[model samples]
Target: MSEIQTVPESRRFLSALGPGLAGALSVTLIHEGARRVLSHPPRMDVLGKRSLKKGLRWFGVRPSHGRRLHRQALVGDIISNSLFYALVALGRPRRPYLRGVLLGTLAGVGAVLLPPFLGLGRSPRRAKRSTALLTVAWYLLGGLSAARATRTV
Candidate 1:
């Protein structure tokens, strides 16, 4: 009985991964699209690279120049989304889709406010108005996608 249960549980965990990947990719696509239209500042890839570079610096490890920064950024972004929905999968939301919207809004707002508190960089309030709004929209969409993905599973 336990072996049978373990198989489905493992499968469920694997299934949850797709939604997370979708969510992350969706956010990236939307962000780029919005940037093209609205001219928002700070490419997410650059921000990811900066964050990763700073992290590596802390450990006395230096990253290579220019090349693979985008790849590194992509991997980091995907991992963050994966980890986030992994929690949702385990938490077993009664209404995953609805929960996703709520979570996304909270997360979007948190993202805007967190930089100063976390000391990552300047808050979006200092950024261009379009940039601030687009950033929040992308984050919200990511959450929606993640939730929708899981629901399909």
Candidate 2:
């Protein structure tokens, strides 16, 4: 009698990582494109640079624009996307579209309200409603993509 060996849950989760990354990159692309089309100032890269700058400041290192900025943004996307999809996968939503919408709505709400509260003083809420909608839509698309992608995993 031979017993079957199963892979660890962590290994299983690792299988889902690529999909999460794809979802994040896709969201960034969609979001940036919308922002450009709407003539809104680029915001995503700024978020990454802001965090990186704060971290570097503690080390007495000054951050700059261009490469460092882009790299940081990509890294942020990877971390955030991985986390989001991991949660979704673990939660095992019955309907991905519904789950995506719910998750996206929460993220959108945060994007709209948190910046100002964080002392960044950005007025997402006060800004034109369409801008907020665009942000939410982008996030929604990401969630939807991630959920669908993870279905294979």
TM-score of each: 0.79, 0.78
The list of candidate 1 runs beyond 4 A from truth reads 1-11
Clashing pairs in 1: none
Give the residue spans of candidate 2 off by over 4 A. 1-7
Q: Model 1: per-residue lDDT, tens digit, 34-78?
A: 656655553566666777888888899987557687678778877
lDDT of 2 by residue, 63-131 (tens): 767986777766876688667755545455477567766776777667777876665557555667776
Deviation from native of the Cα of residue 150 in model 2, angstroms: 1.6
User: With candidate 2 superimposed using the best TM-score fit, by how many Å does residue 141's alpha carbon deviate from the native?
Assistant: 1.0
Give the C-alpha lDDT of model 2. Answer: 0.68
